[model samples]
Target: QFDRKSQEYRALKRYWKLIQQDSRKLSDKRFYRPMFRMHLTNKEILEKLLSYSDELRQHYELYQFLLFHFQEKNSDHFFSLIEQEIATVNPIFQTVFKTFLKDKDKVLNAMELPYSNAKLEATNNLIKV
Candidate 1:
């Protein structure tokens, strides 16, 4: 029985790792909408898995904001949104907000740049070959 339980645990761990990989892929434009739709359908499961954490919910909101509305012109609003999401009660969220505040100028400068790192990733792949 112990051996069988251990095997099941290992299988679950492997499955979770695969899910993480697929979740990362959702950042790609082609996968974003479909994965987001699936996530809405599985909202209850996701909420439970995220442990009903308010910090995680705030982070998810920020992520969605960036994913959909990111542009040079919106940089000010982005930082403002980050400021609004900073929670006084959560040390982790507070630290993250502090870091962002500290590097605000640098981040704003990068946002104004015309180029994106998406193409740079392709160049990196070519260099690795």
Candidate 2:
């Protein structure tokens, strides 16, 4: 309905060029596919992206999702998300995440979850009951 017009917007338009370069892309078939070739240091670059602004903190989830599909060794992106999500953690969160990360195979287990899906599911089940 509306449009953006400004110098920052113009410069930021550049990120759109390679935005699709993210290792994860959706195929025409609506399935997921991973990219194999990526320039080195991409991981560091993605990490640096988070360092830019606190307002962008909300995007950490998207960064991790992309890394899972597109990156094999971009530790920067992975660690950056961890640092952002955990940096200001309270004592309860700190202890819970410390234990959660102990097992990497439990992928659905989330350390930074603000809303527990389990609780949501339980609420739905209660309504059904």
Candidate 3:
């Protein structure tokens, strides 16, 4: 049995968020440090957690692979690989896979585009204010 309130558990939760973070937009490194001072690196902590469950480790690996493809803007490959791999792994991912397929063009474009309208939108909002 695992104690959810344990320091290790808190560190594991942070680890989940860290792995998905885009390096370009990563926050202060100290913000992601473990709940308590520890000699172990984040990688070491993550490896320890992953060792606890094979199923969890498999899901994490799949997630990492998909994220890598998406981040690298391999839109076509991401779509196909996600459908073939992610959909079969779990019901939650099956839902996500279906949603991605439904908006395939938009999703792919977002991934391929080097820029976003976020700044323009912010400026527009400021003018209207």
Candidate 4:
């Protein structure tokens, strides 16, 4: 871990936004080319930041899993396991989990189903308007 007052800690704070961004959306040249201004690629920055702490690495892995693996058949089970595992990792995660638990069935269904009712909801809203 880095000392809170160190230059490395400040750099980590500056780039913290990158941690939650979807990697696929960042594949475009325009999206990633700006990192060159600092002479550090996104991958390199993430590697350096993640290397600082085991919990941060685990959090990153969990975020990636939530983004990419939610469509799998066993996703619901995995999601529950992840919730349990991260229960002590961070308080923010626990808050998010509580929100998900409120709509747990709907959340699981969204993960399992390929199609969404978004269009239907939009049409309903249009009709109401």
Candidate 5:
């Protein structure tokens, strides 16, 4: 069992490296193909039991929105998207969505803050080091 897990971990790591390489390509399609392949691979691993790819795609969309479209006005839309995706038939995704929902207030508060605390966190980490 341990060996099987280790093998799976290594395979995923190599696949991620391939995806990262494609991410550096000039064409959007180049990056997309590997991501799509990875999604398919994930689905195969689960024996096509559920639409895990859709869940992953939705998560990616949410991530992109958070990274690029995070604004006070978009907060409601963000939460709505999360809720919509959470309603899907996937226990794993549902659990993850519930955790995010529980922390919605904190996430929204941080998004509304004018300044980021990333620099502060980095300085604190440096001090600890």
Candidate 6:
């Protein structure tokens, strides 16, 4: 049986290869390195992730710069830019999104009905119309 540890190691190995070939313009290069380093317990891996996140996000060829940075000068402005990018990209996922825009405890408490009463209200409005 393949253990969970083995699986994580395999994922890490795949992650390293993904980073090393980041300049090759492979389809996986854009987001693979940060995703891979996200789970590691070591500082080196974390540094790699941080560096790659900055470098790739600044790169002109990839979509990362287009999303989070662009013409924005500050991190807050950049994050606001990213929020708009996410909203446009995933219109159907507003509630999963509110989870971030709102307080976590509140977001989790409201999770039970992101679509419940709202749908009924819309249905009632349609029926009246």
Q: Pick the candidate with the highest TM-score.
A: 3
Candidate 5 lands at a TM-score of: 0.51
Q: How many backbone clashes does candidate 4 have?
A: 0
- How badly does each model clash, as a count of residue pairs? 0, 0, 0, 0, 0, 0
lDDT string, candidate 3, 1-129, tens digits: 458987556656767765555434544333334454555654555666777677777877777777888888888788878877864587887788888899998997899778799999999999999
Give me the overall lDDT of model 2: 0.45
Q: In model 2, where do residues sit more than 4 Å from their true spots?
A: 1-3, 23-53, 57-61, 69-129
lDDT of 2 by residue, 41-68 (tens): 4443333344454544344445445357
Model 1 ranges with Cα > 4 A deviation: 1-51, 66-73, 87-89
lDDT (CA) per prediction: 0.54, 0.45, 0.72, 0.71, 0.54, 0.45
| Minimal lDDT window, size 10, model 2 | 27-36
Ranking by lDDT: 3, 4, 1, 5, 2, 6
**Model 2 TM:** 0.23
List, residue by residue over 1-129, the lDDT tens digit for candidate 6: 225566444544545543433332345223323535443433334335335445332332233343324223334544454476555444444564464566644433444333447888999999999
Work out the TM-score per prediction.
0.46, 0.23, 0.69, 0.61, 0.51, 0.22
lDDT of 3 at 22: 42
When summed lDDT is taken over every stretch of 10 residues in candidate 1, the lowest stretch is: 27-36
Residue 9, candidate 4: how far off, in angstroms?
2.9
Query: How high a TM-score does candidate 1 get?
Result: 0.46
Better of 1 and 2 by lDDT: 1
Candidate 5 shows a clash count of 0
Q: What is the lDDT of residue 127 in candidate 2?
A: 100
Q: Rank the candidates by TM-score, best first.
A: 3, 4, 5, 1, 2, 6
